[model samples]
Target: MKKTVKLTVNGTTYERDVEPRTLLVHFLRDELGLTGTHIGCDTSQCGACTVSVNGQSLKSCTAFAVQLQGAEVMTIEGLAKEGELHPIQQGFWEMHGLQCGYCTPGMIMQSVQLLDRNPNPTEEEIRRGIEGNLCRCTGYQNIVKSIQWAAQHKNQGQTEIPEASAPKVDPQPIAPVP
Candidate 1:
């Protein structure tokens, strides 16, 4: 059955009829044409399709579009305003947090929520914060550094963003669990 859903996304209101089985990720990508939210693992194991629904970061692939009635959704495309990148996005760019760029959008979204809950997270905390998101390219060292850079500059409005640099060598890749 086709169900009508009304939701706000990126400060824009959208009301459309979607399939009951439609996932939010599909709704955003197919209906609304917001393709920045990538679909990695449809089973929600990967955080590539993460989005902010009512200020909480979640895997969009697991969430039905009908379930988001009257909800506010924020995708990666909404993060920047007036041509200025969100600190997290800027951090990703400056820190070289992404390569191949498949996972950048979801990583940034999750990082935003992570910083919201804990603005000053340690390296371990940052790692744990983004444990759900997977990046196949550019090991997580740069991602961690990117989040750290964002944390350092959070709430500092209009200030010049400093260059992000990690002095230490990149760590060895972690072996996958069997």
Candidate 2:
């Protein structure tokens, strides 16, 4: 049997009939065409399918579309407003937080939630906050820096690129643009 769900995504309301078994990730990606939410593992381990449901970042792959009835959802597509990038998005871009970019959307979503809770998260807190999300290409240093950048610049109303720390990983380093 199909169930009808009302979702408010990115400030837009959408009503659709969907299978009860349909995952929220698929409902957003396949149904609503919000491809920014990626399905890296589909088992919720990779954290690539993260989305904001009622202002909390969770794995969409594990959530049923029907469970989100009347819920306000925010995907990566919803982060920007009026063609301008959200501070988090700008942080990622300026901090070189991503490479290959498969895990970026989820990372940003999770980071935003973290910042919402703790605007001035320490480096360790930022690390602990994003421990759920994984990025294969970029070492976590830049990702942490990105979140830090977002946290620092979130309410400042100014944009400034910060100097990146050396990657803690050995051998291969993902260099950022100077």
* TM-score for each candidate, following the candidate numbering: 0.89, 0.88
Among residues 3 or more apart in sequence or in different chains, the pairs in candidate 1 whose N, CA or C atoms overlap within 3 Å are none
What's the lDDT for candidate 2?
0.87
Best by TM-score: 1
lDDT score, residue 143, model 2?
A: 87
Top candidate by lDDT: 1
lDDT of each: 0.89, 0.87
Instruction: Point out where model 1 deviates above 4 Å.
Output: 162-178
Per-residue alpha-carbon lDDT of model 2 for 1-178, expressed as tens digits?
A: 8889998998999999999999999999999999999999877798999999999999999999999999999999999877878889988887778889999999999998999999899988998999899899877878888888788788686544344632333355645532
The collision pairs in model 2 are: none
Per-residue error at 35 for model 2, in Å? 0.5
